[model samples]
Target: MPTYAIGDLQGCYLELRALLDRLAFDPQVDRLWFVGDLVNRGPDSLKVLRFVHDLGEAALVVLGNHDLHLLALAAGNSRHAKKSTLEAVLRAPDRDELLHWLRHRPLLHHDPERNFTLIHAGLPPQWDLAEAQVRAGELEAVLRGTDYQDFLRDLYGNQPDRWSPDLTGLKRLRFITNCLTRLRFCKPDGTLALTEKGSLENHTVGLVPWFRAAGRKTRSDRIIFGHWSTLGYRQEDNVWAIDSGCLWGGALTAIRLDATSLIPIQLNCKGYLAPGQD
Candidate 1:
C-alpha cells in the first residue's frame, strides 16, 4: 500500500478534500500520515477533525502544538489567551469525543520498514531513534493519563529550553513537548531557539534549523515533519517538510512515501488567515 504523508491541515477542510481528490486517494488502499495541527485557524475545524478522527486505521497522526493547545483549552488550562479559530470545535456537539481522540494521538510515529519517522516538529540533536521514542512515550503517557489536566495547566512555557538527562517533572515534559511539536531553530550546542520561527534565510547567526544542527542523532534516519510553514516545502539531508502553509494561502501538500523519489501532490488553497494574522 502506498503511504501519503500530508502537511498541517489547520482546519482547511475544503482544501483537504480538494487535495485528496487531486491525489485520487483511496482510503481502502492508500495509508495517510498526517503531520498534525488538524484543527484551528481555518473555517472548518470541526469538519476536519471529524473526518480525520473517523479515518481509523487508514490514518496516522502525531499531535501538533495547536492540537495540544486545543486539548489544553478543553481541559480548562486558560493560562494563555484563546486566540485560535477553534470555537467551532469547542462548541461542537461531539466535542468530547473529538478531543478525547485528539488527546490520544502520539507525539512521534516511526516506521522502521520505511526508514521514515513522523513528528509535528523537529527532534533535538541529542536523541537517536531509541531515545526519541522513550522521551515521546513519557509525554504521551501524561497526555493520555488521568492527570492530564495538571500537566496541561503547566504546559505553556518556553523555559528549560534545552534538553538534559537531568531535567525532570513538568520541565522535562515541557522540553520534550516543545521539541516534538514546536521546535524550529537551535544553537550549535542543541539548545532550542523557540522564538525563531521565520524561514532559514532569515535565521540569526549561530542558529541552525534543528535538522541541520551538529551531530544530530537522527540525521541518519529519514524524517518527515511540519510546524515550520515559513520554511515551506523542504527536502534536505533526509528531512522532508511538507507544511505549505495551507491556512496562509499556500498549497495543502502531500508527498507519496512509497516511491523512490518523493512526489508532492498539492492543491492551491484560499487564504483563510493572512500573514501575521496569527
Candidate 2:
C-alpha cells in the first residue's frame, strides 16, 4: 500500500478535495499521513475536520499548534488576542465528539517499519528519536488527561526558550509543545526563536532552521513535518517538509512516503488568505 504524507490543510477543504482527486487516492488501499494544522485560518474548518475524522483508519495525524489552539478555544481558554476562524467548528452539533477526537491525536508519530517519523513541527536538537518519543508521550498524557483544561489555559507562552533535562511542571510541557508544533528557527545552542516566521534567508543572524542546528540528535532519522509554510517543501538533511503554503495561494503538496525517493505531487491552490493576512 502506498502512503502519501500531505502538508498542513489549514481549513482549505476545497483544495484538499482537489488534491485527493489529483492523487487518485484510494482509501481502501492507500494510506494518508496529515502533518496537522487541519483547521483554522481559512474557510470550511468544520468540513475539513469532519472529512478527516470520517477517514477513520485511512488517515494519520499529528497535532499542530493551530489544532491545539482550537482545542484551547473549545475548552474556553480564549486568551489569544487575535480571533480565530474556528467558529464553524465550535458551533457544530457534533462539536464535543469532534473535539474529543482531536484531543486524542498524537503529538508525534513514528513508524519504525518505514523508518520515518511524522510531527507537526520540528524537534529540539537535544532530543534524539528515543527522547523525542518520551517527551511526546509526556505531553500527550497531559492533553488527554482530566487536567487538560488547566494545561490548555497555561499553554500559551514563549519562556524557557531552551530545553533542559531538569525542566519540570508547566514550563517543561510548554517547551515540549512549542518545539513539536510551533518551532521554526533556533539559535545554534538550541534556543527557540518562536517569533520568527520568515523564509530561510530572512531569518535573524545566528539563528538556523531547527533541523540545521548543530549537533541535532535526530539528524540521522528520516523526519517529515509541516507548520512552516514559508519554508515550503524541503528535503535536505534527511528532513521532508511538505507544507507548500496551501493557504497562501501556493500549492497543496503531497509526497509518496512508500517510495525510496520522495515523489511530490502538488495542486495549485485558489488561496483563501493572502500573504500577510494572518
Candidate 3:
C-alpha cells in the first residue's frame, strides 16, 4: 500500500524501470505518482508513454510542459524544433492513443489524506489549494472536451503573462496552461516570466521563483512539482521541486508520500537526452 512520487521521467524509461524495480513497485498494491514530463528530451519517449498509459489505476500523472507540447504538436499546432526527442512517441504505432491519453490528464491533483498537491509546475502565488483545484478542473474540462484540439492549436505564446479572471477564450486557456505547466519565475506582481528558464541567480531583477514569492497565498498544502530541472530538488515549508535532471546524466528522484522525510531512489540515466542538448 505504499505510494511513491517520481520526478520528471522525460522519457528515460530505462531509469524509470530501474528505479521502480529498486522500489519493488507492485501494481497490484503500490501507487505511483508522476510529476510529469513523461516524454520528450530523452530516449524512449514511446516506451515511457506506453508503459504509463498501460498502468491505468496504478498510476496518476499530471501534465508537464513537454507533455502539452507533444499534444499540441500532434494536433498540428506545433512543429518539431529540429532537436526534439519526441520523434519516437510521435511515430509510435499507438501514437494516437498516447497523445489522446496525455491530453486528457489533469493539470493538478490534490490528495487530502497526504496533504499533498501534484502539478506539473508550481501553483501561482495567488492561488490557494482550493483555488488551484477549481481552476485546474476548469482547464481539465476544456482539455477533455471535444474542443480540445481547438485549445491545443492556439496553446503556444506567452503574452498576457498575468492572471485575470475575466480573460476569455484562448488567452484565458493559455494563461492557465502556462501557470500549470510552463511557470518558473514571476514578477512581484505575479506576472509569469515564461522565457526565463535559467538558474535562479540569472533571473532578472524583478523576477522571483514562483515558489519563492513573498507571502505567497497558496500555502494551504504541500505542492510537489516537476519542470525546472535546473532548480533540482528543493523542499521548503510546503513546496517540493523534484525534477533533478534525471535525463541529463543525473539520477532520478522519488519521495514517499506517507513519510515525513525524503527517500530518494537513484538510477543510472546513461545516454539520456536532457534539455538544451541534442
Per-prediction TM-score to the true structure, in the order listed: 0.98, 0.98, 0.94
- Largest lDDT belongs to which candidate? 2
Per-residue lDDT of candidate 3, residues 1-278 (tens digit): 68999999988888899999999999999999999889887778899999999999999999998888888887787555565677777788888888888888889988888878899987677777777888889889998999888888888898779888888888878888899999999988888899888877776788999988876787657889989888888888778888888988767888888876776666656646545664
Deviation from native of the Cα of residue 241 in model 2, angstroms? 0.9
For candidate 3, which ten residues in a row score worst on lDDT? Answer: 269-278
* Candidate 2 clash pair list: none
lDDT of 2 at 225: 97
Residue clash pairs of candidate 3: none
**What are the per-model numbers of colliding residue pairs?**
0, 0, 0
Better of 1 and 3 by TM-score: 1
lDDT of 1 by residue, 1-278 (tens): 98999999999999988888888888998899999999878888899999998989999999999899889888788765458778888898999999999999999999989989999999999999899999999999999999999999888888898888999999999999999999999999999999887788887888999999999999899999999888888899999999999999988889999998897888888788897776
- Better-scoring candidate (lDDT), 1 or 2: 2
Q: Candidate 2's residue-wise lDDT over 125-211, tens digit each?
A: 999999999999999999999999999988899988999989999999999999999999999899999998888978788889999
User: Candidate 1: lDDT of 156?
Assistant: 87
